[model samples]
Target: MAGLAIPTWDPETALLIGTILLEAIVLYVGYGGLERIVGPRLLKLVVGGE
Candidate 1:
């Protein structure tokens, strides 16, 4: 029977995982910034208020 093996460091896998993590952080920050910039304007337009 084969036993479970421990995880090893793989450059390709590390890079892919890092890329995904970086992208998530970037998207989160970008969306937050965009919301801060556009949210109030959008709310005013939707509510028809100045």
Candidate 2:
């Protein structure tokens, strides 16, 4: 454990990580928007609500 070396920053790895993070954020926002748009209609259809 004492001989272990700390990892250094790699630009490629940083870019990959950043892209994944951005994709996750985009997906989250898109899903939330779709849910807000569709959820109530789906619930009404299922529960026979007016």
Off by over 4 Å in 1: 1-4
Best by TM-score: 2
The 10-residue segment with the lowest total lDDT in model 2: 1-10
Give candidate 2 misplaced runs (Cα > 4 Å): 2-4
Tell me the TM-score of each prediction against the true structure: 0.82, 0.85
Candidate 2 to truth, TM: 0.85
Best by the lDDT measure = 2
